[model samples]
Target: MTIFQVTLKNCAFYAHHGVFEQEKALGQRFFVDVVMDVEAGDALGSDDIEQTVHYGLVYELVEKIMTGSRRNLIETLANDVALGLTAWSPMIRRVEVAIRKPSAPIAGILDYVEVRVEHRN
Candidate 1:
């Protein structure tokens, strides 16, 4: 047996997803990365997209979730992305989602804060 993996890295979105009212009202930038273990089936040999997970629609689903809802934690965002990806396509056997928040409201100086989550089907 062989394994096929697909990755979409560092997709950026602006949204309100934090623990403060200011964070909710003001919003911040989030970078999302998704990796999936894909059961490509005939897609690997036949070059047909229909036999695998559609990453374009995957991005759309991520966009919809990020933009449509207000959440208090990036952990929720990560979990949602992982769950959504696995649910969106039966061809996706497993998924990992990472969310990076560059403007996290912490008193320390760092590159960013990230939350990662994984889901398996």
Candidate 2:
């Protein structure tokens, strides 16, 4: 079986997702990266859109999940994205999701806090 991957990186959104009340009240920017492993049996030869995973639809789904509800942990958000993407298509064998919180509520100087989740179907 031939496998292909579709990756969406650094998809940005602003949402309320944190453990603290202040963090919830004041939303911060989040970045999401998704990688979907797909079976490309005929897609490579046929070059048909329907044969392969549609990234536009994937982006929409990711956006919906990112902007949908508030979660206390980015891990939960990442897991949700992984599960959601794996269920979106039967051709998808695995999904990897990463959520990054750049403005995490920390005292010291840091770049970001990120969580990564992977799901297999």
Candidate 3:
């Protein structure tokens, strides 16, 4: 089948998500990326809003997951987000999600921690 891709990358949000007490209390920024594959025919041919995925709504869903609560693992969060998107629309066949934590508490200085997950329904 033909695939239409939608990617929301480097989405930043402030939330309490970490393993440390201080990290949870202070709260920091998290980044999320969502890639969705959907049926391409109708959206590509008609160019109608109804025929395609609404990216804004996708972003809103991601934002809700990001700022909603304190989850210890990006993997769990990513999975939730990916599954959520797939559940949102029947046209969507697969979803890939990446959650990045830049301010994670680590032993030494580092760039960031991230998790990528893919889901199909």
Candidate rank order under TM-score: 2, 1, 3
- Superposed model 3: Cα runs more than 4 Å off: none
Residues 1-121 of candidate 1 have per-residue lDDT tens digits of: 4569989999999998899999999998999998999886888898887777888999999999988788898998889878878878888888999999999888999999988999999
Per-residue error (Å), model 1, residue 88: 0.9
Q: Which wins on lDDT, candidate 1 or candidate 2?
A: 2
Q: How does residue 41 of candidate 2 score in lDDT?
A: 75
Over the stretch 1-121, how does candidate 3's per-residue lDDT look in tens digits?
Answer: 6887888889898988877888789999988888888887677888898888889999999899888878888888888898788888888888999998888777788899889999887
Task: Please report the TM-score between candidate 2 and the true structure.
Answer: 0.96
Rank all candidate structures by their lDDT, best first, as comma-separated numbers.
Answer: 2, 1, 3
lDDT of 1: 0.89
Which stretch of 10 consecutive residues in model 2 shows the poorest summed lDDT?
81-90
Q: How close is each model in CA RMSD to the real structure?
A: 0.9, 0.8, 1.2
Residue-level lDDT for 62 in candidate 1: 92
Question: Which lDDT value does model 1 have at 94?
Answer: 88
Please write out the lDDT profile of model 2 over residues 15-87, one tens digit for every residue: 9999999889989899999988999979999989999999999999999999898899999999988888888
